[model samples]
Target: MATDSAAWICAALLAFLPLSTARAAPLAPGQPAPDFALRDQHGQVQRLADQRGHWVVLYFYPKDDTPGCTREACRFRDDLHALLALGAVVLGVSLDDSDSHARFAAKHQLPFPLLADPGGNTARAYASLWSLGPIKFAKRRSFLIDPAGRLARIYRKVAPDRHSQEIIADLRALQQGHAPRP
Candidate 1:
């Protein structure tokens, strides 16, 4: 009877599994990024328009201090020098409030700025907002924008362990006038 009940539960879960959909968010490469003005942890404004002439690495994460998010942020912090040397400026965005962001930044010793997207409006504009595991907020997404503001690459399935290395590699290739490999 227990075996039968377990099988029934498995079958029910399989029946409710998500079907593959073609309506996923559109790929945004080669298009100009939408400009934004958001406040950072320090309560100062960060305007995308003001960064027009610099290569921008804009990463949207789910939260401030969760495990996976922390790993990703630390990786970014570790590789910050290489990123800046490649002429890229990194910015992190999440639905975390400024106070939370301040704590996360100070705790992690992050060298770059983190933008606070408390209302989720910025995440929605970038199609990076989602809910998971009872937490309603932004999803983990990263975009590499060129100096002229064209979206050069989007990393949706980023591995927190090696994400910074991957971004650094891509930036190096871009600097060398070569297209990055998949």
Candidate 2:
């Protein structure tokens, strides 16, 4: 009888292994961002080190052409000027292929580049890998990388509607030498 109980407990514990493996923590603020070179929507190569002197907004989404993702891209489109003025460049990252990214960008008229993290290399590097059951893509996350290639802030719980405005505010504050709000 004791052996049966032990076997059941072991089976239960083994069943939960997949769940524990699925959840991953995102990158912490103040850590040096992992550098990567991925192709943009146009197949143009983009590397983190290339934009060393400019602030980089590295945003990773689940897929392209989705409602929330579209809204987030549009918000960034409308706020591009403000962000550029604050000396920041926005780069959207996703697991989508280059063709999908191009179509999404053209459809939405996004002003910034949409990078393709085909193997989710950049996503994993930034700690954005999504592992909930069958979902293998990265979660919708945003990282604010400073000019020196260090993560200044991370927007884990993104508000797709207000994402652009919130990022602009954070950039403005950071540029003015103020700590971003929690």
Candidate 3:
């Protein structure tokens, strides 16, 4: 009985841990970014392949309109002009439905496309989807793909509030042929 109790305690503690497992191997810089054709909040199908020749900021968040996600999306919205001026297009992805994305984008007045990945296919391809028993969602990850559709940088752990500016700085450095600091 004591051993069973200890096992139960251990399992309970594990459940409380931040244990997100990536489904695939960690992607490397200069590798081709995974291509995805997903529907956005506006119901338009957005394809990564189509965004070739322009820098792409493909960000995967866990859900829509949550505190962290909102901060991240709004920061992107607030800084959209800077990103565009740098020849970069920002696409936010989440494991939410189109309706959720629509509401979130509209509520935040986010100008960028918030792509829905309800089935987690895109998230898994980027190695960002995480599952804890029945609770599944995408980890907060971002990929900066160069104009040639190659991964320029991978952000495995991101701070929602500060990520956009981080991308902006990196974009400038990358465009200037400066090596991005890890």
Q: Show how many residue pairs clash in every candidate, following the order shown.
A: 0, 0, 0
Q: Candidate 3 — which residues are off by over 4 angstroms?
A: 1-22
Q: How would you order the candidates by lDDT, starting with the best? A: 3, 2, 1
lDDT of each: 0.85, 0.86, 0.93
- Residue runs of model 2 more than 4 Å from their true location after superposition: 1-26, 132-134
Query: Model 3, 1-182: lDDT tens per residue?
Result: 99999999999988787676647767899999989999999999999999999999999999897899999999999999999999999999989989999999889999999999988999999999998755789999999999999999999889999999999999999999998889
lDDT of 3: 0.93
Between candidates 2 and 3, name the one with more favorable lDDT: 3
Question: Candidate 3, residue 123: CA error in Å?
Answer: 0.6
lDDT of 1 by residue, 33-148 (tens): 87889888899999988888889999998888999999999999988888888888999999888889999999989878899987777787787877532345777889999999
| Residue 39 Cα positional deviation in candidate 2, in Å, after optimal superposition | 0.5
Tens digit of lDDT per residue, candidate 2, span 63-177? Answer: 8999999998888999899899999999999988999999999998987899998776678777777664445686788999999999999998999999889988888889899
Cα deviation of 32, candidate 2, in Å: 1.1
Q: Which candidate number maximizes lDDT?
A: 3
What TM-score do all the candidates reach, one by one?
0.84, 0.85, 0.90
Model 2, C-alpha of 24: deviation from truth (Å): 6.9
